[model samples]
Target: MATLPGRRLLQRCAAGARCRLLGTVAEASPPREGDTIYVKRPASAATRDETSVEMPMSFMTGSVVGKRFYRDATVRRADDGNGWTVMLDYRTLKSPAKRPLKLPSRTLAMAIAAEWEYQESDGIRPFTMPLMKLACTALERVPVTRTKVIDNLMKKFHQDLVFCRSPDDNELTIGVHQKQKEKFDPILDWVNTEFGFKPVVYTSFFGGKQDGELTQAVETVLKKTTDFELASIDAMAAAAHSLVIPLAIFRGKLRIEKAIELIRLEEDHQVILSHYLSLYSGSCFSGLTVQCLIPPGR
Candidate 1:
């Protein structure tokens, strides 16, 4: 399974756990904010007490000030080698855990610095800074745990949501088939023509494995992606529960709206019904109308 970087790692506590940095369990008080700890878990009794714990990575541990802290946010070339780093007020920025924020690509570094530059005195919104998050994951997390994350995402690819279809039944059988062709077929055709790969589509949730050739082709593409790209793809794939959908969207073959439509294909009938009801029933009783007016993230 693909293991996410430390920043994405979860926090947990168990007795007798050892630390990653300090060899022995710190017989100290509970860990404070921004602290790293490893809770060891042995695989077998033969290797009992051999410490191996996943430590949680930190990000943005400092409190946000009302005003921007930096006079300027710019991209700077790395002093050690190739690659780039973001400079905040002439000083190099660091990750939440005090690690330097070095990126493999100049474009990636510039993108991150842009997020910092655009931040207002109001507050820091880390959630809005996806590029920065990806940079951190690439720098601190991916280098240590690349293999696990790749394997986990590969496993998820086979059971992608796009590969499964809603089964046809007596009443909705014809409608289901029609919807599949109308909505899903184009996406499949595009992949076949674009990638020279046609993924096997199933008519039921229990559908078996896809063609090995198609899976292999996908793996090949993913293997070539940078750590930043892979992290973003893994995230989008998990959210959509389908590697195909995210791949298409990322490559510009599909848009986010269309991908969302495909993900919710099983509810197409209900959506159409809701749309028509909203159109005919006027604004007062239409949930869809009310929802649209509410704006996003409400």
Candidate 2:
């Protein structure tokens, strides 16, 4: 059924056209805007049949801008023996207390534009996109020194940042942007396989798991309850210490393991915590100062 056309240029088309296979092509009529048309049956090279118009290549130009918005990302040294690090290189990372991060913003913008031009011809749209994020074992390149970068990141994407590191430079890069959201699984899998995130974090300014029995108690609470508490006494202080606790202020839709995985122990009576890591973590507690969940301290 060649609606709005006598016949289509394509002869071997499936339609209600009462035509037979021809060995020659036919000249057809030009098409108009906003017209409904279909290919005709058996086409030929020798027929000058007036039909539909040929479409211009410009009709398909291609792209989505970007996809997803993120604030922080985690990276680790492929061979530097460093645990985990976050690389911030966005205009937002230009903090007053930290060195301004350098991102390929201009370069990325150009890339996005080119990609969109190529993809727009198809039909898709996205927000922000994933790119390469890097991490350095040395403190010389921390995005911010005042607080844990993960803390701030959780506020933004509410999803854990995943990365793959370069063995030589410990830098991470995304092979492609605008990938399916499900693609994130492989990155998390890689992080777990490569980094092996154990539930322990240290109290040192760097933060990591310090091992022992309080670790056991922490594990038990997490296994049985949705959340827990942490009580500590500054073992180095003359008066008291602190501990680590798990807080879920805004972890609603976000996975538990993504952000604020652990908090310092607070008070001196008891402590509680849990692991979103499939509820799998061998807890350990050392001396640390814990304060109630408040923006002032974290």
| TM-score for each of the candidates | 0.62, 0.15
What value of lDDT does candidate 2 attain over all alpha carbons? 0.24
Task: For candidate 1, list the clashing residue pairs, or say none.
Answer: 1-152, 2-148, 2-149, 2-152, 3-148, 3-149, 6-57, 66-121
Local accuracy of candidate 1 as per-residue lDDT tens digits, 270-297: 5565565555566667445443222223
Off by over 4 Å in 2: 1-106, 127-149, 152-298
The sequence of per-residue lDDT tens digits that candidate 2 reaches over residues 1-298 is 1122212312313454322211112232235332212222225534422121211222222122122122222122212332221221111221111322222233332232222222222222322212211211111223232133322322221111222111232222121222212333443443334324323322233233333343444334333321111110111111211122122212132243432221111211112212222122322233544333322223
C-alpha local distance difference test of each model: 0.62, 0.24
Give the Å error, residue 264, model 1: 5.7
- Residue-level error in angstroms, candidate 2, position 68: 19
